[model samples]
Target: MASFVFKVIRNAFGIAEHVAPGLCGRAAFELFCRTPNPRSLTAGEQRAVDQAARFMAEARRHCLTTRKGRITVFDFKPQGGTRPLGTILVLHGWRSRTEYMKSVIEGFRDAGYRVVSLDLPGHGQSSGRRLNMALAVDAVRVAGEWFGPFAAVAGHSFGGAVAVNAAVGAVAGIPPLATARLVLISAPSSMPAIFEDFGRFLNLGPRSQLAVAAEVERVTGRRLEDFVGSVQLATVPIPALVIHAPDDREVSADDAKAFARAGDHVRLFWARGLGHRRILFDPEVVSEAVGFVTARPRLARVN
Candidate 1:
């Protein structure tokens, strides 16, 4: 009876944590970005924007053999003579390809960091036929090696969860733990809640959601609950920037509050207007992220 009561309470809390209203506008915003402007901009302006997008999409499609097997990685390096501020390893969200993170790479490039990213095993150019949360975590673990010690990590949505996993050293085989800074953009802290959300997206009732979740876990050998990638912000000594927008329709804005509860080393940046996908390119966010990572510590004496 005690176990039953605890399970009930746990399930209720999980539901309330990551899922909520405001999802429509988030969906609408994503739709709008893909809607296309249909207006003529200057040739130079269009070329720069489209080329940056192309660099992210086309430049890194080759497969590399890793311990986990042949995995797909999309690596973007800065132009010659562009000294790297640091290395950045990007992880893509569920069902999204590495191309989706072009804005993320763009921000790091502007900061002069070489961005190395992968299509998280089951998505994009990866070889897997099925996408699972654990594979995303696995991709982060193996891919971190390529970025080496001098690196910062960031991700979006499911990818952000993987970043959190990588930062906290939960995903095996990554290194320089306790030293690497982490950036989580619109990350969800709970996994079961997201599955519950997959049901809501289809308007399925409680029973069907639970049933489908169980079946998925059994067939894939990966339980979404088991792969819940929320980082223990309190345990980490490294500085972390957690960014989320309340206007976000995908992941709840309340997650920002949960992250703030992690500890003093964690900084929460909440902006309005930018949706989940487009938030990667928001100029204000780019500035904030660069500033946070590059800022000299208060203890450092200025020359």
Candidate 2:
């Protein structure tokens, strides 16, 4: 049933491409930016969420005002009211909420660092129905201003791309996020590659693809090529840890290698069997990220 519906939509876009490419482009871009509804959590994920609930209950929640809308933010400090080493801002991927990242958040909390996280513009408790990397970056910038100068910023999947862009400061109006370290897990390195994949999925022709690209530029006020993760990461001064599984089906491990090759400051970690989403829950992955975030500057530089 779902396949049939997708085929019908694809054919509609194909026909519309020849009839009214501009209108089709606008509609396609809208679908492209729309956030997917949340899925049922796996048992393991549910268990993690259940365990983190108590920690979340203790967190100080804030509703942050942003250009997109109000975003829900969670500020979790170290247990026992002790002083934190530093704050770590967390961002979840598309279709995921802050709660889905409970395992990672708990790891950070246990490591004695303050953890601040938010639902991207259209996901979780945040407002708006549509989301794009540009809007996500804006939200991060706003959050940085409010609870920033973070010791590190950690993100997964699309959120990882946001972390890179927020750190790169390439967009026209949005300033670079002030952070000392970065963690990008299962992130795509090329924005153009993402668009290409989308175009292939919709069976879009050359004209329709160009039209969609134009719409993206019109909406974001920047060319799609300008947002390549590797390109941006090369210019960022902070050290970054790139984590991805070699067998990840959603995002290529090649992207991770691209990030590592971009600069000496970047370190790549390969999680053998964790795949895309599971990588976030693995104990070793969590430990590696937390350790990287909490490592001393001299030790980090030496590594």
Candidate 3:
């Protein structure tokens, strides 16, 4: 099959690249910064992406240009003459496009909230091929300005990390973006942890890891700790729901625990069997997110 051959070729190349240990570190760093399989949608998947993009575009749509590239945004106002509670911004994770978040989008729509989902730069239909936490945060801020007054933001995986940064940054009065609620699904607590894991997975040496770290710092202008979602959550006063599955193969469930421990305003929920990607599609998970975003507070607390 085509997929099998592709995997074989990729694996062979990977083995050859790692065989020479001296050059392996540098090679690993290159791989670390690059977005592997930049285009992964099959014919059917591509069609789905096209359909979703078209649906979102039927509403108000525009491309916001950033320093790095232009970000495609879809903004849908609420229907049926019922004033929208507020708009909810949804962000997808690494190597994922907004189309993959159909469940979340529909969930918010059914709950009478306007939804805005953008293809982060370097993913989906957006421009660029490399991604870093710092660039992603900047792109979100730009998008927030164009699509002002978000009631809440929900993100999965890497996007969840960005959502945390956006929320905390807004709380800190950086760029003046405001959101009343935050939801993080299967998000990594620490970027450094992910970097180290990637290094081990690729069999990179300590020197290579250091090189990768330096390269990341150079690109993002911030240390790995500065990007950790848990660290940002500690200062975020908005209500947050951290959802994770025990069977998730990528980010650990402990990251959700860290989010919960950061503040009483944050809550942790466990969903079984959804793994990493499916959690975004699970109806129950989407319902929980919708509820959190729309819920009336029992008491008002000043930030």
Top candidate (TM-score): 2
Residue-wise lDDT of candidate 2 within 1-303, one digit each (tens)? 999999999999889889988887788788889886434566765676677777678889889888867788998988667899899999999778898888888888888889999988877778877898778988898889989999999999999998998898856688889999999989989988998898888878778888888887886678878889888888776899988898999999889888888888898888888899989889888888988887732222212
Off by over 4 Å in 1: 1-53, 57-62, 66-69, 171-179, 199-231, 296-303
| Count of clashes, each model | 0, 0, 0
lDDT of 3 by residue, 1-303 (tens): 987875664564456554654355555656765664548767877787777776566556678887778888777766565788788988999878888888888888888988898888788767788666656777888878877678888899988988887776622224535888888889888878888888766645666566677666666666555767776777766788888898999888888778778888888778789999889879888888887777842222222
- Model 2 scores a C-alpha lDDT of 0.85
RMSD (Cα, Å) for all candidates, in order, is: 10.9, 2.8, 5.0
Cα-based lDDT for every prediction: 0.62, 0.85, 0.75
Residue 26 Cα positional deviation in candidate 3, in Å, after optimal superposition: 6.8
| Ranked candidates (lDDT, high to low) | 2, 3, 1
How far in Å is the alpha carbon of 35 misplaced in model 1? 22
Error of 1 at 177 (Å): 5.9
Which whole-number lDDT from 0 to 100 does residue 121 have in model 3?
77
lDDT at 108, model 1 = 75
Residue 156, model 1, lDDT: 81
Model 3: which ten-residue window has the lowest total lDDT?
A: 294-303
lDDT of 3 at 48: 73
lDDT digits (tens) for residues 13-109 of candidate 1: 3453346323432332232123122233357545544666647654545576644446787767765549787777777676466666777777777
- Shift in Å, residue 185, candidate 3: 1.2
Off by over 4 Å in 2: 38-51, 296-303
